[model samples]
Target chain A: MITIDGVTKIRGRTRILHEVSFTARPGRVTGFLGPNGAGKTSTLRVLLGLDRPQAGTALIDGRRYADHDRPLTVAGALLDGSGAHRSRSARAHLRWVAASNGLPRARVEEVLDLVGLSADAGKRAGRFSLGMGRRLGLATALLGDPPVLILDEPVNGLDPAGIRWMRTFLRDSAATGRTVLLSSHLMGELAETADDVVIIDRGRVVAAGTLAEVVGEHATLEDAFLDRTASEGVSW
Target chain B: MTGPRRVAGAVHAEAIKLITLPSLALTVALTWALTALLGLTGRPGGVLVYTQVGFLVLGVLAATHEYQGGGQIRASLLAVPRRPLLAVAKIVALAGIAAPFALVAAVLAGRPGATGGLLLDLVLAAGVGMLVKHSVGATGLVLTAYEIVSPLVRTHLPEVARLPSSAWTAAVLLVAIAIFARREA
Candidate 1:
């Protein structure tokens, strides 16, 4: 389970997250939906302990992310880019990350196969295309086979087939009881894959609940998001 | 994992990064090559002057490499969230990689005072890199510092400290540790 409560963040005098409170339960895919610059990445960063919040807390299971002894085995996260140095081969990148978490070296190959990047194991990360980079990032996330998965715009760079594969992968992950929380601006994508949804606009949670609850009488998730965000020229 | 074990893992991971970074091998080779060139010319004096440039760069890149290639710092911090510990592990790993070479460079320089700041240059470079996150900028700043400090720190007895006062050192050390731990990834 993941809990973000009253989480507020400020960067350079701009309030990026305002009392953002939500919960993503195990065995459910929570789609954190927001438009560009709407604090999705900021929230995820705080949850992962990559950034500090001035107020409130973000918890994985029951403790802060930094408090975990083996955080990778507790929660796996994929943020922007490949998360590997450009000069490093994918295999080398995975190996070091595994070593940091005290995970076995074999998990590197296992995750490479899981993400279908085994063929490109020897390729340098800088040489990867957008789709390939996403795959590499996903491979890094799965290195520990953690129970919680947090991703930001995971399907942003994927091709159609890749997108389909990711959709299936995230669904299967949640089906098997992992807590999956992904942030994206793709409403149509979220509508199809998300069991629950949280919509943020200008650093505030405009709405959140089950996918059905969020969509409500609106024609689709897109409509609901547009109705909430595309108005009054308010973007902070 | 206990604190020490976790630190060990971080250090291990950091060493692997330094080993596999193509630039690391290149930097070390260039430093050693220049050391050899200076040795052959018999201009390798008590303190290595020209060759200190390579060691300075080695340190800066070692510290700032995580901020490159779409920022590996995110992945690194994600793996080891104890930010201060990560920073310390990074330096420890850099020391491990550079120590043997430092000894080699000292022996090759064939002078008593040449070994004074071989690995210390890398640590200094790391501290500068932390102050300036950009590698190019950090490298330039570190080199510039080397230029200014080289004349003063010519031998083993003379030391040029970035923060000479203990109080100032403590203040800067606290600031650096806070930045490493609390800065946004």
Candidate 2:
């Protein structure tokens, strides 16, 4: 379970996220939906301890990410894929990340296989296509086989086959009674994959519930999201 | 093994990454080839001197790529959130990669590699890599000083001029470690 309590963030003296809060429970794919600059990344950063929130806290399984002894084993995360070193091979990349969390060497290969990149595992990430890079990122996230997974924009540049593969993987991951939280702007994508939806606009929760509940009274999930966001206007 | 071994793994990862890239390999090869050419042409020990600073740019880029990319740093921070631990891992990794190169330089200099000074240089390189979050700018400046300023300083202030690259490397590594640990990942 991931608990985000009253999280507030300010970037460069301007408020980005104001008192934003939500809960992502296990056995469900909770989609963190927001427009660009709506504090989606900011909130993710706070949760991963990349940025300190001026107020509130983000907890994974009731403990902060940093507090966990082997964080990779408790919660696995992949925020962005472009951060990989262009020079390093995918195998080397996963090896070091695994070693950091004290995971065994075999697990690296295991996740590589899980992500269907075992053959290209020796290739450098710099040379990977966007779709392949996403696969590598997913492999890293699954390296520890952690009960919780957090992925932001996991399907951004994927092809149809890649999207289908990702949707299945995420669903199966959650079905195992693991907690999964994915963020995306595509409502239809979320509608198909996410069990629950936490919609945010202008850094605050506009609405959050099961996919069916938030999509009510609107023509579609997209219409519902647009209506809710449009009604709120824009704020710092 | 536990203390330095873990750090060694991180450093090994960085060093291996440094060698694996075709660009980095080209850079190092060019440095060595140019250094050898310079040595064979007229200048004595040019290869040794040039190669010493040549690879520093690659070292800096190793970490700079992480800082520039939003993901690697985040993944690294997530796995090892303790800033000092991560910093140490970098130091260990950089040093592990650097040790053999430094020894090769010493061999080219026709001197048995001395552990004390080379260890110091590795430490300094780590520090510089940390402080700059990658060393392109700093490496350029250092190389510039080595070529132009070091000679002038040596002629005028002989005492200051006597400082070895290895010593400066150690100092830089220490400063880099301090700066790296203090910052948020």
True-contact fraction per candidate equals 0.82, 0.49
For model 1, the stretches where C-alpha displacement exceeds 4 angstroms are A231-236, B44-47, B149-175
- Classified by CAPRI criteria, candidate 2 counts as acceptable
Q: Pairs clashing in candidate 2?
A: B11-B93, B60-B135, B124-B169, B124-B170, B124-B173, B127-B173, B127-B176, B128-B172
Q: Rate the local accuracy (lDDT) of all candidates.
A: 0.86, 0.75
By TM-score, who's the top model here? Answer: 1
Residue-wise C-alpha lDDT for candidate 2, range B1-185, written one tens digit per residue? 25565555455545554555466556556655665567667665334555556555656554565665435777777767767777767766656666676566555544435434544533554455556664566566655755688779989999886777666765666676667665666
Write model 1 residue lDDT over B1-185, tens digit each, in one string.
98778988999999989899999899888888888777887762433765667777888888888888666889999999988888888878887878888777777667435554676666767777876788899988767655765445655436445444344334544566677776777
- Encode model 1's per-residue lDDT on A1-236: one tens digit a residue: 99999999999999999999999999999999998899999999999998899999999999999999999999999888999899999999999999998899999999999998899999999999999999999999998899999999999889999999999999999999999999999988999899999999889999999999988999999998888788776555
Estimate, for each residue in A1-236, the C-alpha lDDT of model 2 and write its tens digit: 99999999887888888998999999999999988878887888889888888899999988898777777888888777745666678898888777776678899899988888999988878899998888888888888889999999889999999999999989998999999999989888998999999999988988999989988898888998988887746665
Clashes of 2: 8
Report RMSD for candidate 1.
3.0
Give the per-residue Cα lDDT of candidate 1 at B173: 46
